[model samples]
Target: MAAVPLQEWERGDKTNVEIIGYGWRVLEYFHAEEKRVMVRLHLPADRDKDRIQLAVMLMLRDIKHSRKWLCEFCGAPARETHTFNFFYRVLDSDLPRLVVYCHFVCDMDKRHVREGLTATHHLMNTRFDGTLGPMPPFASFGKRPSGKVYPLAGSCAGCQHEDTAVDEGVLKRCARCKMTRVCGAACQRADWGRHKVACGMIYSVTFENWG
Candidate 1:
């Protein structure tokens, strides 16, 4: 069911009474000026193996810097319910518009954290609500605009390795070549001596060509 806004949450106006359909469920809460919409989606309740595929889909739909959002709900214990949060622009749309989103699982178990990270990685590349597709160029809405690389949220070959920017000023610099990189450290170390003399040249073994 799609989310619906209510004057008060206790009134149960957005409560759903039917079995989940189309791998989705939705709920809503509203106050005087804004609304919140929450959607719980699963690949198929019948099994757990489909989560990876579900994650890929979720990741591919995450867009950078636009108004899309995630909804979150908090709970206790490791096995409790997963919650998400989404914001809405009540005055801007015909009824409400979901704008922000977050995911809340009960605890920080490795599996759950991995899922969360995967979803976040996906968000970096995708931004639509329900499908995997190309994202549109984003326009700034706030006073101080962001000046960072806002990549589309989707699967990239780079997600498997450790983040190059990990911990206390440990720059991902090639020792031999003295060049900076966003790719992981292993690639940098491998090309050190060879890259030193070839630095910044086409034949240089930069991280991009380490493979």
Candidate 2:
């Protein structure tokens, strides 16, 4: 299994510490380093906690390699699977930022329930409070029953349209930020004045050019 960075453990981010705490006892068997805090895994006796430890290790190993959608709790790969994608309200004015985690392990532990519709449904519909109630009638996972998904595509910073280079080949991604997509040269030129500041910030972070 991969090893987590000591720096990350030292940082003591609440979420990070919670995940590490989950499997810390099992992890200690593999690494002999002393730690400031430790918590035992609460899996059934037959179920090994090594898998959880490995998942956490892999997550820390890849944190700086570009993919940021990995499980926020256990560090498992989250994107192409049955992930629980929701938001925790962090700011008063801003829309909730997306948090994704593997449905089977991370979400189950947080809800303190075994695998079932009760856990999955709660993850999709409700907020992050630790409550286990019946699944609401209107709750549906993936694209909804109406076959519509919100934020259909990346909005063009130039035209403010729900289209992007991935969905529309005509659009080209911004050369600097690589986040903004524009319909054409005309749109890119029109948006340049307003986008420059954000573009510089994004470029600096992406390339690790900050000094």
Candidate 3:
């Protein structure tokens, strides 16, 4: 995580925090008591960061709806008192933000997630909250995403079939992300449901940056 400079701000002051992986900004103020000010931002994308953000949003919503806290990642009892409000979609007038308490262990090295997602053309973010309760009913959080394992350079994203495998010479790459590879059309089709979101978002990024 990029170090959030706070030399200018007084403690207990409300601030705005931008959730962009590449920058730092204030967002919301989670009160000393459990304000549980979880945010709901309507957005779309399919990179690792996007995937991870989606995962977290569902979790926060689960916590808010349940009115309790559990460790979002490790399923441990989490009572740490630290919070962050990450707002990703800035173009919109209503920037949704959430400030939830998270464990130091779970919240450490967030920058790694951002950089790793960028390098792999994947996307994700991790900010853990120690909200303990029954395991969330995941079905309510929309379709569970398929496994997003990063395949080898020449392996099939669907079946993990390698280029050297019989009848699998020269894997066909997804033109959208230019990153995902598969053994053939069969494997490509198998992976479509999983790859489509990331593929579209990545290509959109490239399109936006065409200069």
Candidates' lDDT values, in order?
A: 0.28, 0.35, 0.33
In lDDT terms, how accurate is model 3? 0.33
RMSD of each: 20.7, 16.3, 16.5
lDDT per residue, candidate 2, 61-100, as tens digits? 2221122222323444222223332323212213212123
Count of clashes in candidate 3: 17
Model 2 pairs in collision: none
What is the overall TM-score of model 1 with all chains considered together? 0.19
User: Model 2, 176: alpha-carbon shift in Å?
Assistant: 1.3
Whole-model lDDT, candidate 1? 0.28
**Model 3 bad stretches (over 4 Å):** 1-52, 55-154, 162-169, 204-211
- Per-residue lDDT tens digits of candidate 3, residues 51-156? 4455444332222112122223332222221223333332221322223332211222235432332332211232223222223332442442455322222235
Q: How far is candidate 3 from the true structure (C-alpha RMSD, Å)?
A: 16.5
lDDT of 1 at 26: 33
Tens digits of per-residue lDDT for model 1 on 1-211? 4555533211232211111101111343342221122222222222232432333233222211111111222212112112222222222333322222333233333354446535653574465353423322122212223443322111111331323323323434334323333245555456444343333221121111111
lDDT winner, 1 or 2: 2
Stretches > 4 Å off in candidate 1: 1-78, 97-106, 111-114, 117-125, 129-211
Error of 3 at 195 (Å): 1.5
